[model samples]
Structures are given as C-alpha cells and as structure tokens.
Target: MTSYAFTFPGQGSQAVGMGKDLAAAYPEARAVFQEVDEALGQRLSAIMFEGPEDILRLTENAQPALMAVSLAIVRVLEARGLRVSGHAAYVAGHSLGEYSALAAAGAFTIADTARLLKTRGQAMQKAVPVGHGAMAALLGLDLAVASEVADAASQGEVCAVANDNAPGQVVVSGTVAAVERAVELAKAKGAKRALLLPVSAPFHCALMQPAADAMAQALAEIEMRAPLLPLVANVLAAPVSDPAEIRRLLVEQVTGVVRWTESVRWLTGPGGVTNLAELGTGKVLTGLAKRIDPQAIATAVSTPADIDAFVAQLGL
Candidate 1:
C-alpha cells in the first residue's frame, strides 16, 4: 500500500561492475544487458562489469551503461510483480537518466534507448572539443544568485546554469574561461565552495546547441509512444505524457537547465508522492532526494538484495 515515484540516476552515478551482480542473480537483468550490447554492437557489458575505469567513464559509454543498469533493475522489479503502470505514481530522472525512466515506462524499448543514449553521448562529446568547455559547481548559492554570477562572469561567452540540483547547489556550464570566471564570482559572492568539474563537455548550455541539433535529427527518426505513467520532465519540472511533447522536450533538454530541485518539489509537494525509489547504478539521486525533501523516504534499488527487499516491502 505504498505510492512512490521512481527516479533514475544520471551520468555521474556510474561505477565499475555496476550491473554485474544483478545479471548474475536474475535472468531478466541479464537479458536487458545483452540487448543493450546487441543494440550498441559493442561489449559494453564487459566494460560495465570489468572496466578500465577511464573508458567506462567516457560520456558515450557512461550514458547507456547507467541506463542499462537502471533498466536491468526495472526488468527485475517487473518480474517481481511490480508493474510501473499501477505500482508507481510517477517517474523522473536526472539528465541522461530521463531515457532510463522513459524506457521503464515503455515509452521506448531498452534497445532503442541504448542506441539513442549512445548517439546522445557521442553528439555531446563531439559538440565540444576537449579543454575548450567546462562545468563548475557553485555551492551555497541560490539559482537567482548563481544566474547573476554566471551572467556576470560570462565575458560574452556561453556561460549559463546547467543544473539546479538543490536549494544551494547550482552547476554552471560554458566555455572554460566563462566557467572559470563564474567560479571566481560565485566564491566572491559568499558561496561556500565553487570549483570546476572534471567533465569533458560543457553540457546543457548554449554551446551544446550542436548536440541538440543532432538529437533533434536522431529523435525524429525514433518511434516514441506515450508512457504508461506520467513523466516529470527535466525541462518543465512537470508531468508530460504525450509522445510528441516528450520527443520535443528530450531535444530541448540537451541545452536546457535540469530543474531537478523543482521536479523533486513537485513530486513531494503537489504530486503527493511519499516514497522515492531510485533505481540505478548509485545512490547519488537517493541522497539528493533527502536533501531536496527531508520527509520523503528515498530508497536506492541498485542491487539484487535491494530489489528483493523493496519488492517484499511493497507486498509483491
């Protein structure tokens, strides 16, 4: 008798051997991994189970790898009699995690999502050359102040807010110079910490326009269906069910700020979701869920044990 919103982790949640255990424990999980491997025509599961660390961390691999783990967990949960249609109230994901959420809700198949994420990762990386772009985290600064700081620091470059993760954690992405300037301005504006992230591309900014264009073409060819459950889209921080709208939003998300704080607020506030089950590679979103809303019961279902326990708790 529990109603919860299912959330998926984004890029930074990846790790070595992310889905290895679940693959060993469940056939459905294993099948999901195999399908992704076939779709990408690469041994991505090997990288996920046994990584060279750096390769798996590549944006191209990381996007689908994270989604694969999430989809694997979703398949296992389905096998356990947990239907997203009737069991979960809504679904949301962080950045690339949105694809995983859509796949779980049947908006896209696992194979198609894998291919799209692979394309997305490659497009994003190709959009910006190495050392030309950067992203920085500005702690202890609200979105309004962060926006002001980014604008002031832009120096006529493409600097802008990329993610509003929480109340005071804002991330800015842009050319290296602009992001560096934003860091300095944020620190001077009384931020507790402002530091650059070790990311290859300045994602979710105007500079990613090329990637957005690529995704528009890529998404246009793919077949999208309405989700079984509504999705709290990143760009809107609101529920969307139309396939066409979701397609457009997915393209816009490439350069749009991820309104995660607002999305979580909608879930716990007006959406009335009490429990948050984060199904993915790491507990990154789980931690953020509590930070975003203390009263929400956030659980990470990343392992076979976690899935077993969660399914039982739900009376499945």
Candidate 2:
C-alpha cells in the first residue's frame, strides 16, 4: 500500500486556458466551474477557459478559479470511486491552494471555499498599495542565506523571507525598495538570479498583516470542520487537523512564511509519503515534489488521460 498525498498549486500557476479540456470531458468539472461562477457572482470559468489574461490573473479571480479547477479534479476522482479520504494520507497546498486542500478534505464546501478565496484575494490586494510593495525570487540561495539577504537589504523597511520554496529557491517580500535592495544583495551574495516577481502585492510578510486580520474575520464566519485528512499547513510545515487551529493557521499564513521546503521534507521523511498527486491546472507542484524528493513518484493529474493513468496506477 502506497502512502499518497494530494497537492494543489497556488498563484502564478494560472494560465490563459486552464480547465477547458476537463470542462469539455467531464460534467463534474463543468458543474464545479458553474458552482464557482454562482458563488462569486461572476462567470470566472469563461475567464479561466478563455482568458483576457489580465482579468483572469487578477488575484481575486485567480484564487477561486484555481480552486474550482482543483475541486473539479477532486470531484472527478470521487466519481471514479477514488476519494481523497480513502486514498490520500494527507493533503497540502501552496498559498491559496491551501483552501483547495481543505475543501477536498471536507473542511469546507466548494462554494464556501470559492467565496473565501475571493474575499482573501481581494483583501490581500487591498492591504498594500500597488506601487509600494513587491516580491522577489532569490535563486541559488538557501533559506539561511536568503534570510541574510533579506535582513541586509531591509533598511528598516520590512524586507522579509516569504516562501522557502526549495533548497536553492526562496522568495522575499516587502517594500519595493527593500525588495530591490535584496535582489542586489542577493546578486552580491552569488545568487544565480535575484529577480523581482510580477506579483500585485508583497505576500507572506508583515505588510500582509492587514490581510491576515481580514481573513481572521472572514474565516470566523464560516464553519470549519476537521479535515477528512490532516493538512500540512504552510505556515507550520506540519500536519494540523484541529479546525480551530487550522483557522488560526490560515489567518497566520497571510503574513507568515510558507515553509514549503521544510513541509516537503517532513512529508517524505517522517510522514513517509511516497506519492504526490498535483491535481490542478499546471505542473508546478509536481515539479516541486520532484525537486524536493526525487525518490517519490509525482504525478500531475490534469487531463482525462492523466486521470485514467492515475486511476490505473492506483490499481482501481
């Protein structure tokens, strides 16, 4: 029996025509898009299937749109008689993807998750002014070095580590000037690349505290049940099942570091997770899984063909 985990992707993984094929091939996927569209009071699926690029990439739209696709895949899987609780030992996701994981695990309904993510995206975007904040990726630098780079660059302006993505990949977020300074410092520190990201706001840093507060309020209004399976929370890099704690962590995740590298290590090491299924639009998490632990089998379940293959691999 193989121990399996299902992972979902976050922002930046959204594309122009995501989930079009699935919507065409599976009614489950179509209904998911419809449900999200109704929940958000917008036809986001059209934007997802035929995007104007900028509109679909808007944080509010992207967050829920991505979740819809992930949930669609989850529903399709369940329709195939392979449910997350039955097969997955745990569920994890990156940033906005965390809501998707919880939704899959039955902590929240699909419609509730969509509305929550929409609120989250709107709150996060509103937390910082457009030109005041930024995020940057510091490549070829480990977490310690990246932290140093962030610290040295912060001239008292809030530059801080955001995502510890992998062994040599870390993201820093803060004031634009501080992030720019961190890039230069990273270059000086021999980072292969230190480039500013095109994100709308600086996320996972103190600047996002306002957004965290907003999420705390929004999350309190929803009924959070314990997930069907535990979630490897982004902020803690550990599995957490308590609904109260999960709500708190979701709030903290707004302004806390995403311990992605450590989370993956914990899954492969102590959790003994051998298979990672990235069920979403892109191969982003699949790539991360391979980079983090090549020994584990990582599969991207996007297409109908992929769905069949994954089912076959599971001996269904």
What number of clashing residue pairs does each candidate have, in the order they appear? 0, 0
TM-scores of the candidates in the order shown: 0.99, 0.99
Tens-digit lDDT string for candidate 1 (183-205): 99999999999999988899999
Any runs in candidate 2 off by more than 4 Å, and if so which?
A: none
lDDT of each: 0.95, 0.94
Residue 136, model 1, lDDT = 99
Q: Clashing pairs in model 2? A: none
lDDT of 2: 0.94
Alpha carbon lDDT of residue 197, candidate 2?
97
